[model samples]
Target: MAHLGESIDVDNIVPERGDFEALPAGPYMVQITDSDVAETKAGTGLILKLTMEVMDGPFANRKLWTNLNFRNPNATAQRIAQEQIKQICDAVGFQGQLTDSEVLHFRPMRVQLVVKRDEQYGDRNEVKKYSALNGSAPPANKPQPQPAAQKPASSAAQRPASGGQTRPWGNRAA
Candidate 1:
């Protein structure tokens, strides 16, 4: 969540209001977040690059940040990223953060955030907007990536090579 600073300098402050048409309209799941970039991509069949910055929050001069996840590996992630970025920037309280890199990274601050779809949009009955009374993690978008598989351990032991078999099973300790 982004917020105003305790001693904000609105004189030097200017809210971000840029135009982008690279993405389509749909839902986006923010994964990781930072100040430099918004690594967002298509989800719910949309394509776009969503970026943002400073917005009024609990404190002042603060902004909310989030990295988008399409939750659809089959779809073009970048396209969805572009579209999502467009929607997010246009959405209320989404004071677009400017960054050269596509990845999201940023400073800490309060925010009027709407990263989660249900919390922002209520078209879907299953998903719900935020409950300000209860500050908690938003609904999850995708499943976690599974870990890699491992090989099994051997059960047999090594045998002696000097000239004879110490035992039928294996070697006998000297």
Candidate 2:
């Protein structure tokens, strides 16, 4: 891939059809029709068009996905390999083989072909982080809720030196 400016690591990967436990329904292709990226940003991005039917396991599948950016886009095959593993596993789903790309038994499917992973590999924690900050409530161990909302001092309390319409507190106009 060519050089591109900084990119957001959505942390979601579109999996290949074969990865699903069941055959993809049909007419499946990952695509990125529209992007929020600015025109000034150089280089292009890969938007997948994964057909939902492709993964025909069961229930109406609804989930979110994302991918982290490569630490070093240029040079460094090891990093490339790591990101590829991250991509493949993330797309197809990996259990973090404890070797960072180790072939995953990936529960349910348990495909033999998988990448081993290191302890810190395939950060499943990214999702957790997203939820922690952006998601709803934080961990129970987290700090307690702070104070409640309070309105600014009512301007009605203070009439500037300049004369202004004034009304008695809680007074009703009959």
Q: Which candidate achieves the best TM-score against the true structure?
A: 1
The lDDT per prediction is: 0.32, 0.29
TM-score of each: 0.22, 0.18
Per-residue lDDT tens digits of candidate 1, residues 6-63?
Answer: 7777899876642211112222232223334223233244222323333332222322
Compared with the true structure, model 1 gives a TM-score of 0.22
Q: Count the backbone clashes (under 3 Å) in each candidate.
A: 46, 30
Model 2, 88-163: lDDT tens per residue?
Answer: 4444333223232223222111111222334654312112111111223332222334344543365443323324
Off by over 4 Å in 1: 1-54, 69-73, 76-79, 88-174
RMSD in order of candidates: 21.5, 22.8
Question: How does residue 101 of candidate 2 score in lDDT?
Answer: 21
